[model samples]
Target: MEIIKTAIDGVVIIKPRIFTDSRGYFFESFSQREFDEKVRPIQFVQDNESKSSYGVMRGLHYQKMPYTQSKLVRCVRGRVLDVAVDIRRGSPTFGRHVAAELSEDNHLQLFIPRGFAHGFAVLSDEAVFQYKCDNFYEPQSEGGIQLIDDTLGIDWRIPTDHAILSEKDIKRTKLADTPLDFDYNEDLYKK
Candidate 1:
C-alpha cells in the first residue's frame, strides 16, 4: 500500500497494490503491521458499514472529547466523495478539508484522525461504505457541522435540491457556531 499525505496533517489517502488475472483481482485491504509502521499505531475497536444511494450526504460529524474517534474509510461497492474537515480550535488548518474519491476500481482508503469531522456523498447509483473506528460510538458525544456551511467551501457534487440528508444532519450547526473542544497541541494519539 502507498500512503499519500494530504494537505492537512495526519490525514492520508492509501492506495493498495492490486494484482489482476483472468480469474479476478486480489489485494490486501488491511495489514496491522504495515499500518502501524507507516501510519500511527492505533487499534480500531469497531467496524461500521452503510449503504446509500446517489446524492445521499451523510455528515461532517465527530465525537467530542473522551469519545472522539479516528476513522479509516473506504467505499467497496460504488463511488463516493469522502471528506474530512479539521475542526480543532487552534490548528492552522482548522475548518479546512480534504476530499477524495473512493470507489471499487480505485480501492483507495482515507484516514481521518480524531480532531476532524468526517462525511461522504454518494456519486454512483448506490454505494457501500465501510469504516474502522478507533473508539466505540457514544451517541451523547456526537457532534457535527452543517454540510452546507459556506465558510467551509465544500463542493458535495450534488445539487442543493437533489441532495438528501437526515433531520439530524440538517439541524447541525455551522463550524463557527459549533463548540469545539479539541486542542491542536494535545496529542490525540496518546492512550
Candidate 2:
C-alpha cells in the first residue's frame, strides 16, 4: 500500500496494491501491521457501512473531544466524492478541505483524523461506503458544520438541485458558529 499525504496535517490517501488475473482482481483492503507502519497507531473498534443513491450528500460531521473519532474510509461499490475538513483550532489549515474520489474503480482509501469533519457525496447511481472508526459512536457528542456553508466553499461536484441532504444536515451550524474542542497541538499528530 502507498500512502499519500494531503495538504492538511493528518489527513492522507491510501492506495492499495491490486493483483489482477483472468478471473478478477484482489487486494488486501486492510492489514493491522501495514496500517500501523504507514499511518498512526489507531485501534479501530467499530466498522460502519452505508448505501446511498446518486446525489446523496452526507456530512461535514465530527464528534466532540473525548469521543472524537479517527477513520479509514473508502467506497467498496460504485463511486463517491469523499471530503474531510480541518476543524482544529489554531491549525494552519483550519477550515480547509481535501476532496478525494473514492470508488471501486480506483480503490483508494482516506485516513481522516479526529480533529476533522468528514462527509461524502454519491457520484454513481448507487454506492456502498464503509469506514472504520477508532471510537464508538456517541449521540451526545455529535456535531457538524453546514455542508453548504459558503465560508467553506466546497464543490460537492453535484448540482444544488440534484443534491439530497437530511433536514438535520441542512440546518447545521456554520464552521464559525460551531464549537470545536480540538487545538492545533503538534503532539496530537504524533499519535
Candidate 3:
C-alpha cells in the first residue's frame, strides 16, 4: 500500500497495490500492521456505507469532543470528488482543505483525520461509498460547515444550481461561524 500525504498534516490518500490475472484483480483493503506502519494507529470501531447518484453532495460534517472520529473513505462503485476540510481553530491549516478523486477504477482511498469536516460529491451516474471510522456515531455531537461556503471555494464537481443537498445542509454555517472546539497538530496523534 502507498500512503500519500496531503498538504494538510493528517490528511492522506492511500493506494493499495493491485494484482491482476486472467480472472480479475485483488488487493488488501485494510491491514492493521500496514496501517500501524504507513499511517496512524486508529482502532476503527464502526463501518458505514452510502449510495448516491450524480450531483449528490453529502457533507462537510464532523462530531464534537467525545464523539470525534477519524475516517478512512473509499468508493466501491462509480466515482466521486472526496473532500476534507480543516476546522481546527488556531492551527496553521485551519479552514484549509484537500480534494481528491476516488473511484472503482482507481480503487483509492482517502483518510480524513479527526478535527476535520468531510464530504463528497458523486461524479458519475451513481456511486457506492464505504468508510470506516475510529469512533462510533453520536448524533448529539454532530457538527458541520456548509459544503458550499464560498470561503472554502470547493467546487463540488457538480453545478451549484443542480447539486442535491439535505435540508440540514442548506442551513449549515461557514467554517468561521461553526461551533468548533478542536485544533490540529501532528503531535496530537504522536502521543
Candidate 4:
C-alpha cells in the first residue's frame, strides 16, 4: 500500500497494490504491520458500515474530547466524495478541508485523524461505505459543523435541492458557532 499525504497534517490517502489475473483481482486491503509503519500506529476498535444512495450526505461530524475518533474509510460498492475538515481552533489549517473520491475501482482509503470533522456524499446510484474507528462511538459526545456552511467552502458535489440529510445534520451549527473541544496544541494520539 502507498500512503499519500494530503494538504492537512495527518489526513492521508492509501492506495493498495492490486493484482489481477484470469480468476479475478486481489489485494490486501488492510495490514496492521504496514499501517503501523506507514501511517501512525492506531488500534481501531470498531468497524462500521453504511449504505446510502445518490445525493445522500452524511456528515461533517466529530466527537468531543475523551471520545474523539480517528477513522480509516473506503467506499466498496460505488462512489463517494469523502471530505475531512480541520476544526482544531488554533491550527494553521483550521476550517480548511480535503476532499477525495473513493470508489470500488480505485480501492483508495482515506485516514482522517482525531481532530477533524468527517463526512461523505454518495455519487453513484448506491454506495456501500465502511470504516474502522479508533474509538467506540458515544452518541453523547457527538458534535458537528453545518455541511453547507459557506465559510468552509466545501463542495459536496451534490446539488442543494438534490441532497438528502437527516434532521440531526440539518440542525448542526456553522463552524464558527459550533462549540469545538479539540485543542491544536494537544496530542490527540496520546493514550
What is the C-alpha lDDT profile of model 3 across 18-58, one tens digit per residue?
Answer: 99999999999999889978898778999999999999999
Which residue pairs does candidate 3 place in steric collision? none
**C-alpha lDDT score of every prediction, in listed order:** 0.96, 0.92, 0.90, 0.95
* TM-score for each predicted model, relative to the true structure: 0.99, 0.96, 0.96, 0.99
As a whole number from 0 to 100, the lDDT of residue 22 in candidate 1 is: 100
lDDT of 4 by residue, 28-79 (tens): 9999999999998899999999999999999988999989999999999999
Candidate 2 lDDT by residue in tens digits, 87-174: 9999989999999999999999999998899999999999999999999999999989999988997899989999999999999999
The worst-scoring run of ten residues by lDDT in candidate 3 lies at: 182-191
User: With candidate 2 superimposed using the best TM-score fit, by how many Å does residue 94's alpha carbon deviate from the native?
Assistant: 0.4
Error of 4 at 18 (Å): 0.3
* TM-score pick, better of 2 and 3: 2
* Total residue pair clashes for candidate 2: 0
Cα miss at 15, model 4 (Å)?
Answer: 0.3
lDDT score at residue 141, model 3, on the 0-100 scale: 91
